[model samples]
Target: MSGEFDRVARLRAIFAGAHRGVILGIGDDAAILAGDVLATGAVLSTDAAIEDVHFRRAWIGQGVTWRDVAYRAAAAALSDLAAMGAEPRAMLTSWAFPRDVGDDVVDEIARGFRDAADVYGAPVIGGNLARAREIGLTTTVIGAAPARAPRRDGAQAGDVLWATGALGEAALGLAALEAGIAREPDAAAFVSRFVRPPSRIDAGRAAAQSAHAMIDVSDGLLQDLGHLCDASGVGARLDALAPTREADALARRLGVDARALLESGGDDYELLITAAPGVDLSRIAHPIGEITREPGIVGATTARTGFDHFG
Candidate 1:
């Protein structure tokens, strides 16, 4: 509740009722742009990836190419709209580069942006370029949903929790890269998960049909769950026996417990959803836990919070 949460909370408290015609704002995956598209409002979100903070130079040529960086950056922002079950409309990018960075490298970055934009059918609308001390990239994605996109505050007590895909692979991938073990034979999946995580757009959009509340798991699962809980004014209790989502072989390679990684790793880009009891979610997500009338996550053996910039 300290770092990002506190900052967002302060902003929310100060800006309450400040914006008009916003379908949703401040505490959800993406803010609604107040226009109808497919019977729902348009969604808008922006994300930034700094050269050192979000990524590193070692990975530029190794696990990820420059194009991959642009792709990942776009994917990260688009994931927010995915959480809202929004179909992508268009994207704009703002880039800051060092003075000596060559034009060829810049071209490669452009290629990366173009390639990623093409994937979502989200054109790279024009944006600004400026001189900077390091590589700074920002992506703004717009999307729409037919059914109103899922909201974080819609969960009802007694809803069950579910998620899409496995978790922690990206975290392990980052671990491998940091430990100088990325060159190992089994590192491909890890690197791919880390460098180009899936946005789970389809999964999220499907969940929106039945989910009482939803959020994208950008931080660790625990932290994102807390966001959902806070938004819904509710509590939760996870199943102790909920299966680990990381690959066992990869966990062994990293000398880590797969369950631990699944619980705490960031950047999986999966969906965390809470749906009405008895809702059939088999096709879209895996059952993970249940929501409670009480106000905190209980029954977990280890307490954890997801990645926070200042934690």
Candidate 2:
């Protein structure tokens, strides 16, 4: 057999005896797993960070540091657990790093991981290291949600959709970094967003009890919400008034297209949730819009609102 075919066969053979807890093993975008201990249900989620694509080492010029990247990666993974309305318990990180990177850089990255893990009481249990031309990080997080695990498919018609925290900040942060505007005062807020995104752990947990369906806003509000609608087989009508505060400010200050920024911007990592009609959900933080029955359609009050991955 050819080398490529032989490699596939070898991998399949290696994974053949993987245990029952393995929800999804090799040959998928991510591997899903369950725990050996019995419980209501288990949650498994994964996230990836790549050099140049997700971030650049050069961007940390001068006073900046690589430890920030480690913290961001850990938080990003935990955010997935939060979206499922689960509490993170453990994380397994895999790293690929270049040969030239010093040990101090690696140590700082580890420190970042430790700091973020401490924030949510989740600890890194195990991981693997490998050599590569560029740095890449992949973290798989495991969590548990008492009995009712919130799912992406649970949204219902007439449910209200909401997002926690401000939108487009992370995107704008990236913009600031790209423009080398880090010295500005406003840039600090954006830089904090880019370097350390707040994973809505507490907010997501609270929302889980009331939310019909939920997802973390990692890939921009519009695109991620589209995934929710697709999974739940429903449509959504976005209230233009909801996104106004952030969108308008971002538009005036940075010359960003408010609608496009809110819709398509990624890495906000806030919770995108759907709740039943008249659910008395005002107590929840950052309720953005409502869910409807128009399948495959997301209606925004204003034109040109929403995210397009390819656009």
Candidate 2 per-residue lDDT, tens place, 98-158, comes to: 8777656766776777777678666665566677899998998877774566789999988
**Span of ten consecutive residues with least summed lDDT in model 1:** 11-20
Please write out the lDDT profile of model 1 over residues 123-206, one tens digit for every residue.
554455677999998988877763666799988889999988877778888888877777677877787787777767778778
Residue 238 lDDT (model 2)? 75
Instruction: Tell me the number of clashing residue pairs for each predicted model.
Output: 0, 2
lDDT of each candidate versus the true structure: 0.75, 0.72
Q: Which ten residues in a row have the lowest lDDT in candidate 2?
A: 1-10
Candidate 1 lands at a TM-score of 0.83
Top candidate (lDDT): 1
TM-score of each: 0.83, 0.81
* lDDT (C-alpha) at residue 153 in model 1: 96
